[model samples]
Target: MTRTTPARPVSVEAVFPELAAHRSRTTRLHPRPGRPGMRDSHVGGPMLWPADEPWPVCQEPHRPETEGYAPDEIRSARAAGTWPASRSWPGGGTPGEGGPVPFMGLAQFFRRDIPGLPAGPDRADLLQLFRCPLTHGSYLERRYILRWRRAAETEDADDFLATPPQLPLLRWEDELPEPCVLHPEQVVTYPWAEDDTLPAALIARIDAWEDAQASRHGREAPSYQSDLSIPPGWRVGGFPSWASTGPLTVDCVSCATPLRLLLTAGSEEMDADSHSWVPLEDRDPSPHANPTRLRFGRDRDLHVFTCPADPGHPPRWLLA
Candidate 1:
């Protein structure tokens, strides 16, 4: 089913014309549980991978594969509509003792399905993402691997890998995302209130306006931070919310070029208080809001940024 975002109650640009200068277009990936084929753009769905290519594996140190379910086991539990929340790993060992663990196929996006996608490296037309199911780095950030491919060329290969390798054990089962198809809808958005792009004077004015509105309504008013600016959910190419980390410079470590938002795997499509951003079709009571069931950094949204100047540069991820 197609997903459509309801119109904002008030046109933000009408209230604060300055926002128009910072307006950005983002494609909200309304992901819902389904069996998406390899050719489709989706989250946690089967990827169109060529047999010749080796599936990505995380060589990063992990706690020995002691006490976690295998990929097939997780899939079985999900299919049976039961979650083994308390399931323990089969073995016992310390962290950083495990060998290579296969990366999970996280997402796939076809150039034809998404608008405003950066040109793929080597003029490729498909973008695939894989993630280590465990945390990494000083921040305990989930590691990601990106692959670009020419869809036509890959699909025309003699044979395709039937299934990518899966992790032998998954200690962080909640990070596993349920396969879901994408219903991409482009929407206009603004930067977070704390973004440096906005002048201090303008921010003060906006704050005063909000206060006046709240006093008049005798309750908290519609907020620019939550209601007018940066939308929640899995999306592409929009501004990131600085509400958490207060906007750190996401520059390319190799070329020093400013990076752009490539994708977001948010925990929720819409929160209970974000009813305005809810799609009209999803207003009826349902659990579609968190269909992907992807959890990251204490349920914080994961944002991936890629260097626009050079697609080959390693992508960076932040949890906000």
Candidate 2:
């Protein structure tokens, strides 16, 4: 006699109890579009991760060894005719002695969140349930974060205007935020609400974009992964004058340690190139007199300076 196996349950409730729980949680919270969630702020602010939650398992970390080229080696090789001189470095430079070199790789490798997903499951779920304030679409979007120097605050300015007007704000779509091209080690998410004053319509759009990403993810088959690289035509910009004329100081975003500035564009090869961030030997308070000054505003932002103390190492994402 043959033995028979018991039949498994086929009901919707049986196959995915967790999905049901997710739905219930989202329904209970009923977050309005643009409202602050537990993981991220409705207004711009730092990202918060819950201590008790399990981190998502599907994240891909950045692999620098696999994707990056050594600056010194690349430069030497180029000088020897091994690599093309026109090749651009990510974050855009060779590491100098005094100042920290700007990171020159992909941005995705530095962040850990899933592209297009909120920082945590709670925010992701909340965003999924949110309806577009304007179109009522269920899609979500992603945005990018940009950094810039801060200017002094003024009493007359609005509370939101405390930072410099030229400071680059990190912005992204709620649906599919771009991954750091180099670091793939981390994912960039909404660190804060935009201006601490997001409109409901905008929030809805974010939610819709996120939903769209999820749908696309589900429908697509997994594909082979490749190393990230800078787009051919793109180049990193924005260096400060202090970087070229040394004794420069820069603080790390992660550790707050001070870095020293060393070397600006040195040598004839660096000087001849219009788009290179060559290291300098020392501060030249009179950098304005240098011919490179003409390149500023005309070709790119002034080169900023930094040092390589602990925690002051440039982020890898900036390289690409």
Best by lDDT: 1
Per-residue alpha-carbon lDDT of candidate 1 for residues 160-226, written as tens digits (9 for 90 to 100): 8887777556776665789998899999998877646588878888889888877887544677777
Q: Which tens-of-lDDT digit does each residue in 52-120 have in candidate 2?
A: 322221111211111233434443553464642333434533222222112111111001222222221
What's the TM for model 1?
A: 0.92
Worst 10 residues of 1 by lDDT: 86-95
Error of 2 at 218 (Å): 15
Model 2, runs deviating above 4 Å: 1-14, 22-85, 88-93, 102-320
For all the candidates, what are their Cα RMSDs to the real structure?
2.2, 25.6
TM-score each candidate: 0.92, 0.16
Whole-model Cα lDDT per candidate? 0.80, 0.22
Error of 1 at 85 (Å): 5.2
Compared with the true structure, the alpha-carbon lDDT of candidate 2 equals 0.22
Report the number of clashing residue pairs per model: 5, 89
- Give, for candidate 2, the lowest lDDT window spanning 10 residues: 223-232
Please report the TM-score between candidate 2 and the true structure.
0.16
